[model samples]
Target: MQHLMLVPVLLPLLVAALMMLLGEERHRLKMALNVGSCAALLAVSCLLLLRASHDGAPQAVGVYLPGNWQAPFGIVLALDRLCALMLVLTSLVALAAALFACARWHRVGVHFHVLFQLQLMGLAGAFLTADLFNLFVFFEVTLAASYGLLLHGSGRARVLSGMHYIAINLAASALLLIGVSMLYGITGTLNMADLAQHIPTLRASDRGLLHAAAGILATAFLIKAAVWPLNFWLVPAYSAATAPVAALFALMTKLGVYSILRLWSLLFGDEAGASAQFGSLWLIGAGMLTMAFGAIGMMGSQRLGHLAGYAALLSSGTVLAVAGFGQNLLTAAMLYYLPASTLAISALFLLGDVMDRWRSPVDGADPYEPTSEAAPFLNARLEPTRGFNLDEEEQALVGRPIPAATAFVGLAFLLCTLMLSGLPPLPGFVGKFAMLNALFNPLGLAASAGAQPGLTGWVFVLVLIASGFLALTALVRAGIAHFWTAQGRGPLRVGLAEGVPIGALLLSCVLLTVAAGPALRYAQATADALHAPSGYVQSILGAEPVPSVAAGSTLDETAEATP
Candidate 1:
């Protein structure tokens, strides 16, 4: 149990290294390894979450020090309710994406399994690491893997989009490094717990530099979160990538949100004296703008892929705004919304590929627009085929059955549309309602004298409602064009690999809806833990190094030397 914290990072690192030793021709072995590793990761993440949530435990937070070094001096990894939840979410998405990729996408490129495992390693590390410097290291690892994954298919459009994606992320990485340097120069420690401790005691002269450094650091996170003005690259690049890659990229955006939530709450909570709640209003404003931009983009998008991309942007905006509010209940609701929206959007990405293939041109003509002569049942006249009679073609179509694949695709699309639009009875609607409830009654009890929502709250309500409407309209239009008007098409041959993963994701959404009570309770606990981070701080900083095993040395003697 003590070593479990290391498995999320080490397991993937070891697996990827082993896979790298195998030749590219051994795809079956690679696929098996990828799926097996993802499953193991999901299992480990669940165990961590349970451990973090146990009520009987003295402390739910677990901190690990590599080489048994003390905190603020050597690397630290901490697991609490919030980080544990994120780990579970990351593992779930990765597993589904890996299963879907095994159908065909993995074969399209080289080193895919290796990169996939490395990507998981980075994500796990980013969520677990408790310092600024190692966060940057894990960020690079994740980005490096994503770069190769984005260009896996190697097309002209992918090349162009990949270049843009690479350039922007590289710039963000540079900003991150600079910010880390400035922060270290000012505070003299990079551990987040240590920084939080040092922030309140800083000299008056250093406050300005601290804020500047924090702002630069935030810009990098915002860029990755796809906030407005910095997110123009998201739709084009995401829509151009292959299906499975785009699905995995959904979690990548949320990683930025997680970073902001983790750092901001720890460093700027009520304990920060004059710096408490700094830049929060800016976060709210940016979030609103991002939501509006994403909603408008969704309404105007033509392709399903583009719509899915915009939907991801909209989801990011919603969570960012909610997090900025700094209210415990609102953050809890956003936590529920986060995973639900991510899973639905990922399903949309995978479904879009099948729909696109389903609508491909057959025999150089529109499959849905047959001549009226072929169907004299219609009250219109049209030219007939030169070699075949209209009556014979119509007779040939009389008993043809609708394909099972078509039905499955249409049904899956409908469910995705409902979930994304936040319609009733789905987890999406439950999440939104929870947010609205929390916004109006922030204390989670009867309304008090000054409990009314402010102007920004009302504006956020309007944006949330309007975005759902726009998303519904756009998806309905796409559905009508694809499913309703089609008359004659061949059966789509969906592989079992593809169908099963989609089913599993959608079923998970259903389970969330059914079990909203416990899920919300967990989310509330996570939110509470985040806002009151003393436990997190103490767990990391107060942890002692393991005593050395040198001969003839007392345990106290080995532990007495301070790092």
Candidate 2:
């Protein structure tokens, strides 16, 4: 069971290597391997989550030393509730995106399966690594894979967006390196736990250097998290990518948020004396501004893809602000919002692809008009094609009719809209409500004295409400344009490959709503563990190498202890 921590990082790497050896024509086998690896990853992540949660009375944290050396001297992987939860989320989203890609996107480009698996490996490593250096390595790995994935279909739009994406990320990577090097020079150690243990004892003169390095590091992460002015590249890049790739990219921004949450709490929490909550004010200010920017973008978006992109930014900003609050309850609520928004945005991307196809002109006829043989109740004929095309000019089918696909797309869009907008009966609303409740009652129902939310809290509440309203208004307008105003579209040919993944994502959101009780409890526990990370630090730094027997030791004595 202790060795299970290595599987998430190793399995995808092995599978990717194997897939690389095969010819590109062997796509089916590669697809099978990729999907199988993802499924296995999901299973392993669930076990890790359970173990971290201590449901089986196991340790709450597990540490693995890759080179069999003691901590601070060797590479380390640490798994806790937060890391396990992220692994699970990554696997779930990756699996869905892989399945959706099997319909067409996988074959459109070379090395798709290999890059996909590598991306997963990088994500898992980033979550599991116990040092700042390895985090930088994994960030580069993930970014490299994303560069290829973004250009999978090779359109002018993709090429343009991909270049900008590459340039910005390359700059961020340089900043990350500079920050990490500065920290190492200042502290003499790159291990996160060691840094956490050493930070509070630093001399007053060095504190300025430390904060500068930390700020530089945080700037890189905030750019990835799409916070305000640094986030100009997100919508264009996301909107231009192929659907399945766009869906997978939904988790990429959240990874930035995850890094901020992890490092901020672990290194700068209350235990850090003078450096406690080092940049809370900056985080709050930037996060609120990010929300306002996203809201305005959402209201002005002309495409559903653009809307989904801005919605992601809004979600990131909301979580960042909550993290700034430094309240366990609010953090728990943000955790809930995190996954709900991710699933919704991913579904919206996939559904937007289908909607784009539905609105497209077929057989040179007007896109809005039905053919002579088309009727409201009849099935429209699908023209067999080599594969799905990304261009609007390509004709894939003809005629128009009402079918189950239309109904499915419409209903799924509604759920996504409601979830993104934080409307009733969904996990989005539930998450926001929890945050508001925590803000108004910081004492969590046990205290007799009533409390008032301060000016910052009130401002946060207003931004949250206003973002939701703008999202709702924007989505509702887009929905009307797609579903009501252009009603005569052909029956959408939603393949099982495409429909299943979208349905699964939305259904997961629904399940989240239904199981809010247990989920919230888990989230609250996770948040509590994050805010107080002494256990995590100890587990990482205190891990010891396994005992070895001397060459001259007797077989019986070695067997008795080793096994």
Candidate 3:
């Protein structure tokens, strides 16, 4: 059980290695490995979730030892409910994205499979590590692979924008490194579980300095989360990347949210001094503004790619704001929305890319072949094929009459609506319900009352509702501009490879909303664990066993252990 925690991270890497050894020649072997590994990972995640649910435990913490070295002396892998859930979510999205990238990889001769596997490795590592420094190392690994994928096949514009993305992330890396160094210096511990236990004992002055250090680290996270001021890099990077690359924006930003979640409970627990010192209030404000920015940008934007990019920005902000609500709210919001939203958003971005392909006027193989030398892989397809059979589903959705097949498209709109507006039955709706319920408590009510009353909450609410309205409005406007209102719609070709990912992601999205029962329950457990934090600490480090009465009483005479 302890060592099983490493399976999720190890499997993908081993499979990816197998694929890499096959090289660019055996596409069949590579495909089998890619699909097989993801399916396996998904199975692992579901098993983890089941065991987690059955134990009457929020989740068991599994530890993986390398070369049989024990904890404290060697690196370890930790798996709790949150990490397992993320592993599954990341696997699902990566599978879909890999499927979507299949044609391009075959056509262009790029090692899309290799880049993809590395990306999965990074994501799993980020979620599983028990050490803060290792967390940063994994963080860089994923970002680097993501940068490669994002810049793949786009030209100078993407490279130019990706450069900005790199610059911002590199700065963030520096800040994170500094923060970790300060933390280790002060606490004499790098293991998260150990640090959490020791944090409460720091002097008031040391606490203040640590909090200040945390502020710097938090700023770096916000940049990745795409929260307002630090968010400038996000939209540009998304716009410049390929469709499959853009799909990963969801994963990339969630890294930030996950870090914030981990840090808040692990470092700034009740044991750590003040809530004010953690600076979550500022995060909430940033989220509020981010929602508004996305809504407004959606209304004003003309390009589909940019619109999708802005949509990602707003979603990133909401997660941050909701997570900033502290343990109960953060745990609930993350458990509820993170995976579902990642599904929806990744699907939407992929759909946007498909739409671009369908409507584009570029001739045969132009999108696939790299012509430009500057960013050889960065060359983009700008035009649609002349004679292709567009799917009835896509045709009807984009068509003037809005045919019966439009159900999925309509579903997309509703998913976005429920997600952005925070309404009921939907997971986003219920998740927000959890927050609303949490807020109804004395502490919550106080935060609500003090939440800048009119402007802040109202603005967030308006942005939420308006973004939903705007997305629908844009869909309608698009129907008019492309399907019903435009000229070139006789017939278009549809491929199963193209549709499988979209459909799978869509079905899962609906399933998640409909089946929020278990999800919400799991969420509440996470919330409880996060607020009190004994669960997280115990998971990574062996928990304290209940002491026998005589043993407890004799502790006074026993020597206290010192580090």
Question: How well is each residue in 327-415 modelled by candidate 1, as lDDT tens digits?
Answer: 77888899998999999999999999888877775444433344667564332333455333345344333323566887888888988
lDDT of each residue in 37-137, candidate 2, tens digit only: 98999999999888888743222578899998888989999998789889988999999999999899899899999999999999999999989999999
lDDT of 1: 0.87
Output the lDDT of residue 129, model 1: 97
Candidate 2, lDDT over the whole model: 0.88
Q: How close is candidate 2 to the true structure, as a TM-score?
A: 0.90
Q: Lowest-lDDT window of 10 residues in candidate 1?
A: 444-453
lDDT of each: 0.87, 0.88, 0.69
lDDT tens digits by residue: candidate 3, 43-84: 777787666556656645666655444545467677777777
Which portions of model 1 show Cα errors greater than 4 Å? 55-59, 362-402, 442-453, 486-488, 551-553, 556-563
Worst 10 residues of 3 by lDDT: 394-403
lDDT of 1 at 220: 97
Scanning candidate 2 in windows of ten residues, the lowest lDDT window is: 445-454
lDDT of 2 at 152: 94
